[model samples]
Target: MGKPTGFMEYDRKDNKAVEPLERIKNFNEFHTPMSDKDRATQAARCMNCGVPFCQSGMMINGMASGCPLNNLVPEWNDLLFHGNLEKALQMLRQTNNFPEFTSRVCPALCEAACTCGLNGEPVSCKANENAIIEYGYANGLMKAKPPKVRTGKKVAIVGSGPSGLAAADQLNKRGHDVTVYERNDHIGGLLMYGIPNMKLEKWVIDRKQKVMEEEGIHFIVNTNVGKDVKAETLLKEYDSVILCCGASHPRDIKAPGREAQGIYFAVDFLTRSTKHVLTGKKEGWVDTKGKNVVVIGGGDTGNDCVGTAVRQGAKSVVQIEMMPKLPDQRAANNPWPEWPRVCKTDYGQEEAIAVYGKDPRIYQATVKEFIADKNGVLKKVKLVKLEPKKDPKTGRMNMTEIQGSEFELPADYVLIAAGFLGTEDYIAKAFKVKLNARTNVETKPGKYQTSVDKIFTAGDMHRGQSLVVWGINEGRHVAREVDEKLMGYTNLP
Candidate 1:
């Protein structure tokens, strides 16, 4: 440990975000980073526990409890505290391929499982991570390092999201030729489009893409594997194929007036908003100006929809959650070390409250139908309250909509952010890969290989919708497997 008593001496300090009202004025990242000295002090708070559960990457009580990348948390914290920022950055990159993406968007499972958090505030691991990576970038320590020798093994990665990028990075570092195929017009599948510019600016993705390009990884955008390029062609050309196409089939609400003009899927809405920002054109954009926006499903994506709508000058915003509100603090069953099942007010919700004079979330509620005008544009939403009850036979908790509790709210626009189902069917069908009942690609338990020979899968396509950090972990893990398969032995860490 850099300082045995550092945890006792330093209180946790995180980056300060610009006030919501001001930040909402524009779609830009608003977290003002702490200075190098202050960030080092925050890193010093790492107690360097004997067990260090912060990097355990274990699933406890159905939720991840630590850094999924198994990042060397204590080692990097010690390095950072001692002002060895370049070393700290190296230690971080040892496990995580993209700290820049995760530092900005990840929920920080490490902090939840931190030893310090058992009794007090956790070490500012996420902030420290962001600081270390940002310092590397600012100091020119993070530069393209293309492999000197080629293994002559060609690998095709079918998505350009975090998972694909990580896989490409690792495989390329191992002297394999990697090509990433993105169906969208732009790369960074979710990062480039699904996320708003406020949370993760497009330039950050572009910057990383530039570095990856310089590192000799090939990228082919606007190419759908199943359609534009034949799957058989890739299978024939590449030594191995890894599918990182994320779980993109959005789950939809089966409510009336679903075809209303102003109603959109959350992904579509966010994608359009980001495309408009990047292209500076309003081709097929859903304008939310001076309108009442009701975002269905109170998840992070729903919250993003709220934020995006507000920035688009929506008159009012409401986020509906079918489940009951979680307790403000961790519940009795959710003890320390398990992922905290408590309420969290995200930046978008904070902005909604500041602008609308009240919190935007409506818990234990769902939309009944969409009320549309004669023009078939969404005008309002009929809502109903829900109660959770154990099914008599299955013993599963199911949301039961209460009768005689229907209500209406003005909603000129309705964005369904109900999360994803699985990877689209065409990609799996093209490769003749099996899928589980959930529509996710079927791989052997604890394996990334598919039913087809020389074909692999990772990230949401393999495991279903999850965090960006988990995607990186899957990508790195799959790279090892592919390397072993190719070389008959592997050296990838």
Candidate 2:
């Protein structure tokens, strides 16, 4: 440890956020980076535990406790504390392929599992990581280093999300020719469309894309794999095909007035908003200005919708959650080093509160029906309160709706932020890969190979809908497996 008493001496100080009202005015990243000296002090708070749970990346109670990529938290913290910026950057890059994206959007699982968080605040691992990576970018430490020799074997990655990108990066480093196919007009799949510009700016993705291009990786956008480009062609042309298409089939709320005109899937809404932001075109945008909006499903996507609506000058916003509000503090069943189950006010909710008079989230409630006008345009919504009840057979708690507890809200625009189902069927069927019960491409337990020979799968397609960090983890493992299969032996880490 650089300073043994640093944890005791320094209190955790996070990067300052722009005021909610001010930040909602524009869709830009709002957090101000701390100075180098201040960030080093925060880094010094790392206790360098004997067993660093921050990097364990294990499953406890069915939730990920640490970073899925197994980022070296303590080593980099100590290096950062000692002012070794280049060394810290190298250490950060050893495991994680993209710290810039994760630092901004990741929920900071490493911090949740930190040893210092047992009694007090956790070390600012995420911020320190951001500092290290940004330092590398600013000082020209991050540059393309293409392999000197070529393996001549070509690999095809079928998606451009985090997992697909990471797999492409690793395979290209091993001298294998890599080509990535993206259905969207841009390279990043979810990163380009699913996420809002406030959390992760498009420029960050473009920056990385530039570096990957310089490293000899080929990218083909505006091409859907199953429909536009046949899977048979890829199988014949490339030595190995890796499917990284994400779990994109959205879960829908089945209710009356479902055919309303103003109703939209959360992914489609976010995608349109991002498209408008990037292209500066508003021809098909879902404009919510001066309209009352209601977002369904209390998740990250819902929060993004709330934030987006606020920025677009929505007259009002309401976020509906089926589950009851969690305790303000961790419950007794929850302990240190485990993912805390507590109430968290995200940026979107904060913006909503600032614009509206009160918090927008209505916990323990669900939409019963979508009330529409005569012309089939969404006008209002009927919501019903929920109560937790145990199932008689399984003894599992279920949110049962309470009769006679229905209410109505003025909702001109209804955004369904409910989560996604498994991978879209067209891509899976086109590849002819077997799907497990969850609808994700079935591989041998803990393996990346698909049912078809010379075909591999990773990320949401292999697993399920998950965090960006886990996607990267899946990508790295799949690359290693594909490399071994191609060369009969592998040196990839």
Candidate 3:
């Protein structure tokens, strides 16, 4: 609970962003934090709903309706409302290990289920979380405090993304000897390479890494599990292997001339861009200077591609989403108290508007083919309009191309940000874990024991591509389960 009358007293304040014109000039984070006082007021707007569905993490229509971590939202909100910053930070860290990353990129399911959002706008739960985390770090309240006992167990984590980091944090807290093996040279996977630094500064990740290192969690960079280091060898060396390698497979679009030189996966493109930004050099990086770029997807990765392309001084940026246009207001199916499915401009769209004079997204598009030159460089794209149709068996709506709706677009470069298709092929193949119907490493929910007795899988590799918060949650939960299975009982967070 927050201030009893806070919801009546204050309307929710919005997050501030740098002007699109200014932000597009360089690849820097455009978000500007709300003042401490303002962020507190925003937190105070959390209504004292008797049900408190915002933290329930319940299934409404078979979709997650709130924070999966079930964070102590109300307690922290009330703590912040009373100007108890230190107490709020303590309450926040009890549940979430890395609020910094989630604060920047999380979808904020909690805000979607906020009671205040039913009739009007939601409380700024996301911003409030960001505020407390930032405040703790600024006041030196966030630092390393390693566990007191040594369990004498050695664990090898195969990834350094959110899930891996969360697992490592939990295991190290149990006094397990933990060494994280990151394939890339950098420790943070998508956080360092896939995400642009402006939205999330590299230093924030570095700061967290320093704290983890201080807590005795060893991180080995540039050591890939399947390549540089053998996967089987790791499984034998560690007490138990937790596969949090994440779903790195980028979904590709098949069409004529798709093998053109200018085409690349969205993950690869974003990774290369971040590499250049991190190193302060443009060599071997994906350069968009004076090139016509077409990104095929409408998700966050696609938006990130647009923003990065704009910053790289591309001639033009066009994004195509296969789905039909969304409604300006919530559809009847998505009523109040549920996450509203409505049209709203994201950061990349705002940047596109500033540079191109309009938003760069076209809805209901299907690629017919990619037209390439003799040298195998893309020159243009042939497209067709799509209409939703119901499947005969599943009854689910499928996109169908309309006859005579074909057209062509000038696309010099194509980036496929079509999302992921579950875990990669080799890691799970090495472990010989069974695949679920969705091709993800199969396991019962909350029971991460893989087909192999000592092996376990969690995060996107097991659950399918999802938000970072869920990855952290799964990793923490699996670490606890593994600890309990190894010993008779355990204490892990």
Candidate 4:
């Protein structure tokens, strides 16, 4: 409660985004952070409610209500409001390992559950976080501090994504020699390639990697654990092994003409786009210039594809979504302190509308078939409308195709972003760990240890495909559990 009437006096303000048409020229982060004074005003708007659902991190109606990391939202906001930026940075980093990554990528569940948003707009917690972190970097407040003593216990983390990085950071802080193995040519598995440069520039990840390395965290990239390097060797060498390899398997769209050329998975497309952006190489690039693109599965990855295609000078873009459109406002069944179920026009769709004069999303529709030419090159897409229907036995709503509502659109390229199934089987097989019904690594209820001794898991590999925040959460928890099992007690927060 920096100011009693702060919420009333100051309205919520967010970072300004670059206009769509102009920003489509390059794959750079577009939003410009506000001044320090404006950020303080935004931080002042935090009422710091008695309960503060903004940090509850609870699940209601199967959706996250607040930040899964349980970030100290109110304390940091108050500190920022009072211009205590050094203290604010400390408070922000207490729970989050990488604010720079989450500030730009996270959907801001904290703001959605903010008390101020009950009747009006929510506080700009995400923007404030970005400001605090960027300030730390600019002012040289963020630096590497390696542990003074080593515990003589070496731990191996099998991924370089958020979860693996967070776990490595924590264990390294506790005097354990931590080694992270990334399969890709660079560290930051999903952060490096899976995400586009427009949202999170690669330099941010590189900067964090530099700091983590200075903190005595060894990184081994361009060497896969299950393939190039044997899992048995790591298990034999390291005292404990933590598998943070993400759910690398992408869900596929099985339709007629599925084997046609120009049809690619969303992850592969995005990875290629990012690699080309970073290296200026064309070996694996999927050029979309002058092409008509169709993206299946209207999710974040799909939106990234839309934006990427637009930047590559695509003549047209269409996003096919199987589910119906959400309402503009929250429905009556939905209430405050819960994740809102409302339609959101993301950056990519906004760009599509700005360029094409219409929203690119086709709600309640799916790909019936991929219509290709004789040479197996994708030329058009057959789309069919869908309607919600309830199953008689299961009593669950399902999207069924609508009769006689098929349509066709010119599509030279098709990107499937239908989400992921689970962790890849090779790594699981390498470790000989059991998988659950959902294909995620199985463990005891509410635990991170796997069936094999001295073996544990976290992040998308342990839980399933999820946000970076959830991955970091699982990483911190698994580190604590692993620390306890090794040292007979734990001091990690």
Candidate 5:
């Protein structure tokens, strides 16, 4: 610990963001960087506990406890405390390959599971990492460190998202030839499209990709294995193929007026908006200019839709959730360390609340019908009260609608951010891979092996749709599996 009494002396102070009114004017990042003095103090707050729960990315009571990549939180924090930024960057890069991406969009699990969080606020792990990485980049400390020797072994990684990227990075570090395939014109799959610019700028992903390229990882854009290129060809050409396409099938809301023209999926809306930002074209896309927009579903994607609509000059925005509202604090039975199922404002919610008088999310409400205009453009949404239901046979919980409590609201565009169901079918079918009941790629515990010999799966493709941190974990483990399969014994860490 840099300062024995730092946590007590220095109260938690994080990076301040740009005011809502001013931030909504552009699509650029608004969070002002924390001063070096403030960041150093925050870094000093790391207690460096005996167990270091901040670096112990293990599951406790079915929830992620701390850093998913098991980042050396306390060590890096101490390094930063002494202003040894070089050592801090090296320690940060040891585990997390892309701290920039996680530092921005990730829901800092490290903070929630921090030992300090039990009594007082936790150390500013996320903010500190952000400050450190930005510091490294600004000071020209980060550079391309390619492998020393080539292993001559080739790997074809499907899906250029976090999982695939992490796997390729690890394998490349071991001197293996890696080629990443991306369907989109850009390299960073979800990061390039699903996330917005205000949260994670494109340049962040671009910089990482450039570094990986220098490390001998080849990224092939506009080449899809299932459609553009054959998956069988990849299996034959590469020594090993890793599937990481992700659970991309967006769950749908099959309600009245489901086929309305302006009504779209949340993924589609996010992807289009991001593409527009990257391409600088807003024509033919879902333009929220002076239009009332209703985003169905209350997860991160729904909130993203709300924020994107607001930035596009949405006249009004309302986010709907079928689940009942959660308590502001942890429930009685729910103790510390569990992922707090509480109602808290995210960036999107804060932006919406700053613009609209109140929070944009409305709980215990669901859409029954989407009214459309004569031209088939979505005009408005018809909503009804929602209640919890118990199954008579299985005793499973479900949602039931309340009668005589239906209402309609104006909406020029409706975005369904109901989340994903499972991985896409093409790659799975091409490889003849088996899926579990949830439709995710089937994999046994403590194993990354698949039914097809020599082939492996990871990330959301093998597991269900989950956090990017989990994807990184799966990638690292899968790289170990592939390495073991290749040369009997592996030395990757």
Candidate 6:
């Protein structure tokens, strides 16, 4: 450890955020980064525990406890504290393929399990990670380093999301000829479109893509693997085919008037907005300006919808969640070193509160049905309050709507952000891969291989929709498996 008593000396400090009211006017990142010295002080608080659980990546009480990538947290923190910026970057890159992405978006499971946080504020590990990566980029430490020799093996990776990109990066570094195929016109599957620009700018993705291209990995955009390019063609042409296609099958709202003109899936809404922002065009766009917006499902996606709507000058915004709100502090059941199941106010919710004078979220409530206008455009939604009760047969908790509690609210646009079911059936069918009961690609337990020979799967497609960090972790693991299978040995970490 750089300083044994550093934790006692320094108080936790994080990046400054732009004021919610001011930040909502533009779709850029709202965080103001801390200075290098301050970041080093933050890193110095790592503690370097005798048994550091920060990188354990353990599943405790059905939730993740630490970094799933098993990132070398202590090592990098020590390096940063010692003012070895390059070494810190090296240690960070050893595990995470994209720290920049995770630092900005990841919930920071590492911080949740931090020893310091057991009683006090945790070290700013996430911010330190972001600082290290951004420093590397600024100092030109991150550059194209193409493999000197080719392995004469061709690998095809479908989907250019986090998992696919990670796999492609790993395989390309191993001197294998790798090509990534993306269905969208641009690379970065969800990162480019599903996420709002305010959280992660498109130029960041573009910059990484440029570096990957310079490193000899080829990217083919606007090419749907199963449709535009036949699955049979990839099977025949490539030595191995890795499917990192994300689980994009959106879960739908099955109430009456679901087919209304103004209702849209959250992904579709976000994609449209990002595309409009990138292209600077309004033709065929879903406008929320001066509209009463109702967002269903109270997760990150729903919050993103709220932020986006507010940015577009929405008249009113309401986010409905079927589940009850969590406690502000950790409950008795959730203890230290376990991922805390507590209420969190994300960036979008803060902006919503600032704009609407109250939190946009309506907990313990759900939309019962949609009321539409004569032209089939959505106008109002019938919402019902719910109560949690034990089911007689299953003995499991379930939500039931309360009697005489239904109410209606005007709604000009409805966005369903209730999460995804699994991967779309078409992609699974195209590859002739078996799907699990959950509709996810069925790979061997603790393995990335699918039922079909020469076919492997990773990320949301294989594991169901999950965190981006998990996608990157699986991608790296799948690449190691593919490398070992092809060359009889692999040096990939």
| Per-residue alpha-carbon lDDT of candidate 4 for residues 1-493, written as tens digits (9 for 90 to 100) | 7987999998788899999999999999999988888899999999988999998899998999999999999999999999999999999999999999999999999999999999999999999999999999999988999999999999999999999999999999999999999989999888889889999999999999999999999999888899999989999999899999999888998899999999999999999999999999999899999999999988899999999999999999999999999999989999988899899899999999999999999999988999989898999999999999999999999999989999999999999999999989999999999999989999998899999999999999988899999999999999999999889999999
lDDT of 3 by residue, 1-493 (tens): 6578888899888778878888888777777887878888888888667887788877688678888888888889888888898999999988898999998988899988888888778888888898899999999998789999888888888888888899899989988999999889888778888888777888889999999999999999988788788877987888888888888887889898888889999999988898898887887788988999999999888999999999999899999999987899888898856766777678888888889998899999979999998988889999999999999999999999999999988888899999999888888777788888788888777688888878888888888888888888988998898898777798776
Native-referenced Cα lDDT, model 6? 0.93
Identify the runs in model 4 with alpha carbons over 4 angstroms from their true place: none
TM-scores, one per candidate: 0.99, 0.99, 0.97, 0.99, 0.97, 0.99
Shift in Å, residue 441, candidate 6? 0.5
Error of 2 at 450 (Å): 0.6
Predictions in order: lDDT: 0.93, 0.95, 0.86, 0.93, 0.87, 0.93
lDDT of 3 at 487: 76
The segments of candidate 2 whose C-alpha lies over 4 angstroms from its true place after superposition are: none
Candidate 2 structure lDDT: 0.95
Model 5 C-alpha lDDT per residue in residues 1-493, reported as the tens digit of each score:
7888888888898788888888988889888877898899898888888877777887878888888899999999999999999899999988987889899988999998888888889999998998888888888877888999987889889998889999999999988899999988998777788888998899999998888898889999998888888877888898899988999999998898988888889888988888888788877577888989899988888888888998988889999999998898889777777767788787778888888888998889988898988988788899998889998999998888888999999988889999899988888898888888898888888788878866789998888888888888889989988878776779988
Clashes of each: 0, 0, 2, 0, 0, 0
What is the overall TM-score of model 4 with all chains considered together?
0.99
Output the lDDT of residue 27, model 1.
Answer: 90
Worst 10 residues of 6 by lDDT: 277-286
Per-residue lDDT over 1-493 for candidate 6, one digit per residue giving the tens place of the 0 to 100 score:
8989989999999899999999999899989998878888998898999988899999997888989999999999999999998999999999999988888878899999999998899989999999999989999998999999999999999999999999999999999999999999999888889889998898889989989999999999999888999999999999999999999999998998888889999999999999998998987689999999999988889989999999989999999999999999989989989998899898888988998899998989988999999999899999999999999999999999999999999999999999999989888999999999999999879999899999999999988888889999999999999999899999999
TM-score of 3: 0.97
lDDT, residue 74, candidate 1:
99
> lDDT for model 1, on a 0 to 1 scale?
0.93
